[model samples]
Target: MAEKKWMPRWFYQLASPRWCYQITGKLLPIFAVAALILLVGGTAWALIYAPADYQQGNSFRIIYIHVPSAILAQSCYMMMAVAGAIGLIWKMKVADMVAKACAPIGASIAILALATGAIWGKPTWGAWWVWDARLTSMLILLFLYLGVIALNSAIESEQTAAQATAVLALVGLVNIPIIKYSVDWWNTLHQPATFTLTERPAMAMEMWLPLLVMVIGFYCFFAVVMMLRLRNEIIQRERRSSWVRELISG
Candidate 1:
């Protein structure tokens, strides 16, 4: 029988570079337009409509970028690890493409996290850099992303590169737990999680709501960037194929 759903049930079958290319191609425009609308509108709302913190005042506003970017930085690494695992285990072309595609985007998110963290630190901790547990783990996470990117680019064969990078990503997962729990695990200046929308927030709504929008906006923005990179990866991996030629020609 034909598949009942829009997507195939077997993940390996769907991991062809060609398949990933077509799927991401269809999703690109929709994500692009939506991301633009949400990110811009949300940032404006967060920065302008959101109230200053009772203690930190307007300086707390850095959370709008810092928080989301940090969360995504960790998340993007996990996602890359999953893709790399599939590529290593199943030898899927799309898995390699996906693993490759996520590197630069994840690295960018890590940069955003670090910069915004430093910016936030200036006001909260009175210092730019700290070897705090959370901050240090987060820094390691950034380096891991960079390492995977470099490893993948350094290799000539996609398979070998994907396998090596996948191992690195999985080993790096230990840092994710450390990053998330750092505030609780150790005495640190970086504050605990604040802007929970689905649940209650430690702070008042006037201050937290816009931050929620900013988080969602960051997610949408990341999706848009991922799609853009995935599109390029598709082209690179499928350069010898017909669909790629058609896509490029068109």
Candidate 2:
């Protein structure tokens, strides 16, 4: 009884699909509003107010979109893998759904990163394509996302699909650090990190501040989309449940 009393209410509540769906519904609007404000404000500030690079000039402005998408693409894979692991270990349906939802979103962001990188490359490197270490690893990351999506679609059993993708995602984790450190590890055409946690930004604040806003805005946008997808997954998976049925009825 004492142990039960000590247990957090939200801990058990997290296991309820209905609870999660309702909670996400409430939170989605807040994320949407914040994302809209930050993204619009950041885009305007970066494109208009930020000074051009002394070296790269206005071409460097692409970083405003490229960097954030790259960051999100990697972060989304990590989140998907962690969620997959949770589903595998504890058999959480919500966790499985979350992992499934992340694939398409992550894949799209990875493609955006690659496209932007290619566009940036033409000006800086005088070529649109290169087999550089960072570029290759990021390409592999895109393939990994695609593999997960493909595997999930091919498998008929939902449980089996989730478990299989979980293993694949875990295996793919090895590539993330490789993608991160490839520029350092190899003589590559791609530049090193613009922002590092251990040191001050290499670029000036005027340039990086809008990037900061864009990054935050991208994260907010990711949250909003993930929640929306999760809610839809819950509704589909839980359609037979009384709560879902009542929700539909009402």
Candidate 3:
């Protein structure tokens, strides 16, 4: 007989809700600690050590928060869409749970980005709001997040809801590129990206370093939040499983 290849045990464990919950439980604390340290240290560095913009002065510090939130929001949505696709394709409950958990977090971060952008704009643009291409596309991203959240909640069957939301997420994936390229495609008041792989930073190391810290801190924070939410989703979806029952009883 020909030899048959089987997936590794570790891969199977990763697909298990119980295993995922346990792994996340171990990981959550590490990410939480990292998030706390980085966010606090980054905030202090950004506020106290980083020099002010000659033109914008202290107002430029808000970029530490705004840029990170905006980046995280887009990243979260992309993850959610990919998770949703996994659920749809593989019928993996864990992927559905992950997708479900991502929506509210992504929405909240998107809102934070928008709010901070508005605040940053007032000083730079002398206006609180503008119909800029980037701004409008970001707004559409927020709406897409809301649509997935609503669709999931509205469906009666869990599997049906997952499928519906997955399709919606896939459709909405088109908007992500629009948001990314909006500035280049159209002349907008919004500034270009601060950090790009191909281009050297325009700002001094003192300015960009704290911003880098804040960005890393934001990513750690997102991991912490998403793991917490994913753990809850696992428990909720797997309540009937023996591990969940034991966990609850314990």
TM-score of each: 0.92, 0.96, 0.95
Residue 86 lDDT, candidate 1, scale 0-100: 82
Residue pairs in collision within model 1: none
C-alpha RMSD by candidate, in order: 2.3, 1.7, 2.1
lDDT of each: 0.83, 0.93, 0.91
Query: What lDDT score is found at residue 6 in candidate 2?
Result: 61
Better of 2 and 3 by lDDT: 2
- Candidate order by decreasing TM-score: 2, 3, 1
Q: Looking at candidate 1, what is the lDDT of residue 148?
A: 94
**lDDT of each residue in 1-250, candidate 2, tens digit only:** 8778666564457667988999999999999999999999999999999999999999999999999999999999999999999899878888899999999999999999999999999999999989999989999999999999999999999899999999999999999999899989999999999755578999999998899999999999999999998999899989999999999999
User: After superposing candidate 2, which stretches have Cα over 4 Å from the reference?
Assistant: 1-11
Clashes by residue pair, model 2: none
Off by over 4 Å in 3: 1-11
After superposing candidate 1, which stretches have Cα over 4 Å from the reference? 1-9, 197-199
lDDT, candidate 1, at 46: 75
Write candidate 3's Cα lDDT for 1-250 as tens digits: 1223345464467578988998899999999999999999999999999999998999999999999999999999999999999898878888999999999999999999999999999989999999999999999999999999999889989999999999999999999998888988889998888755477899998999888888999999999999999999988888888889999999
Clashes of 3: 0
